[model samples]
Target: MEKGIKAFQCVEWVSKRKVPHTIDIVDPDPSWPTTFTQLATGIRAALPATVIHAVHHVGSTCVPGLAAKPVIDIDLIVADPADEASYVSALEAAGYHFLFREPPWYEHRLFALYAPPVFVNLHVYGPGELDLESARHRLLCDWLRKCPADRDLYARVKRESSERAKANGEGVGEYTEYKGATIREILARAAADAAAAGQGREETVEAGRAETAEAGTGIE
Candidate 1:
């Protein structure tokens, strides 16, 4: 099948389902890391050798002790994300469903897995496309894992945002907006820390990006 057609089918399939946005955060699950490892193993086995540039455990769940919705956000860095023909079929065969194709967003393609025991947002990015966001993801996870103060602040903000969204009868959009400003502030601080250490600053995560929330409700 053509990629465009497959993407359309995926969208239609999602529309027919009743997936809902997460309304609350939970304590960091000890099993999340293992889940990510298993998912990455499956993905690695499915891709061609040349396409497996890197696999990353990103998003809120990656940071130990950080409260998050129970979903794994993974970045599968490939040599050419635009070359869907080479990888998509194999991914499908491995039980991942291609739910999104965003050429404008650094040529990102998203796959989703909704089987028992695991839920994952598999994001594929080409070389240099996610350099900034990728750096932000890694550093933020590292910083939060080591710095208790920042981690507490982030968790508090997340709780407040969840409350606001629930009260406002809004979905992920409201939750994301209420959380974005705080996240940016944290990222700025992280960048400053990097600069002071003479490690240089990572670029903002939103630059040259196009993200869609319709794929699923998890905040990845």
Candidate 2:
């Protein structure tokens, strides 16, 4: 099937189900980590050894003291995704189905857990060089954990968006377009901040290097 059609099909499938925004506001269960640990172990076993770099439990489940859906999000860094169609199929055989093929988010290939909303989201990103996946995952988790004030704001936005979408005819595409906008905004802001921080770190390193050179010490 065409990618667009497949996306629409996924949306249509999701549209039939109902999810309340309260799902977002609910306190996260402490067992979330254990569940994620089990998921990561299962995925590590199922994946082809060659393609794997690191499989991690990301998203809200990985962050302590953060509210999130009960679902688990796992990130996989592959050596080469384009060349590993077989690995994708292997994952499919393990009961994960392709849901979103989001390229805007750094060549991401998302697979959904068969159990539905509370299921797993496997984010496949290429190579160890692509730090975007892990960085974004950490940023979101950190932001939510440290900034409790944003939690309700996020929840309210999510709840309002969810209700609005449901009223206006919810489906995969529309739901994604709606919710994805918020996610994208958060990501964009985080990315800008990371770039700035990286620049500052480089500057600090350069200053340290000058000092070390003056001291006649070799670079570490």
Candidate 3:
């Protein structure tokens, strides 16, 4: 089932939706993809083939050259997000314990489970119900991959956030959200830049099509 998943669909989701946070700007671990591959395999084995569209490593940890919290943020694109009960039942059968569900924020249902300190955060997003979080996350990672200066700036914000989290002894949500807000601004800028580039590409393609049509008409 994992082998049947769509790679471009992952790209499309990132391009379309607005995600929560952007990339982490620091040295990356070469083993990130290796970790994700292992996770995806396990998820594929657990999830029912009918409901799981694709399981992705969509958070900062997935992106290379980013400093993440060492937690894997996996998105299980289910057929229906509201069918949390179905997933709850099925996953529990597969040894995953349901932890927290936050519906107010984009109707996104969160689940958690511990496997010997390899803590995983699972965000279940239903089909056609995407909010701002996913796309925002993709843009942040994309921008950092292309622009080193912005990435450096992001790393500093993240480090400062880490310090605050340490000094104040804050929880994961608080630390994540505060630092995330800063990255969101950068995501917005990257989004605008991307929109402009997309428009330019479309215009060029349209112009070529028009020329082709004119030449065809002349043949008649």
How many steric clashes does model 1 contain? 0
Tell how far residue 80 is off in model 3, in angstroms.
0.6
What does candidate 3's lDDT look like per residue over 125-195, in tens digits?
A: 66543423443444556667777777767667777776776678664445555565555466556665666
Per-residue lDDT for 13-127 in model 2, tens only?
A: 2121223212332456788788778777777788777778888677656667655556677778777755547477787788777654544333556676646435666777775
How does candidate 2 score on lDDT?
A: 0.54
Candidate 3 matches the true fold with a TM-score of: 0.70
Query: What TM-score, computed on C-alpha atoms, does each candidate reach?
Result: 0.81, 0.64, 0.70
**Candidate 3, residue 65: lDDT:** 74
- lDDT per prediction? 0.68, 0.54, 0.54
Candidate 2: which stretches are off by over 4 Å? 1-27, 100-105, 128-134, 172-220
Candidate 1: tens digits of C-alpha lDDT, residues 1-220:
1223322233322222124536477888988998899888888888888988899898788888899877788878888887988898999899777876656545667777776444777877776744444555666676678778988998998889988999989876677778776676676666566666666343443321222221222344
Q: Whole-model lDDT, candidate 3? A: 0.54
Model 1 Cα shift for residue 88 (angstroms): 1.4
Among all candidates shown, the one with the greatest TM-score: 1
Any residue pairs clashing in model 3, and if so which?
A: 17-135, 18-132, 18-133, 18-136, 19-132, 19-133, 19-134, 19-135, 19-136, 20-133
Better-scoring candidate (lDDT), 1 or 2: 1
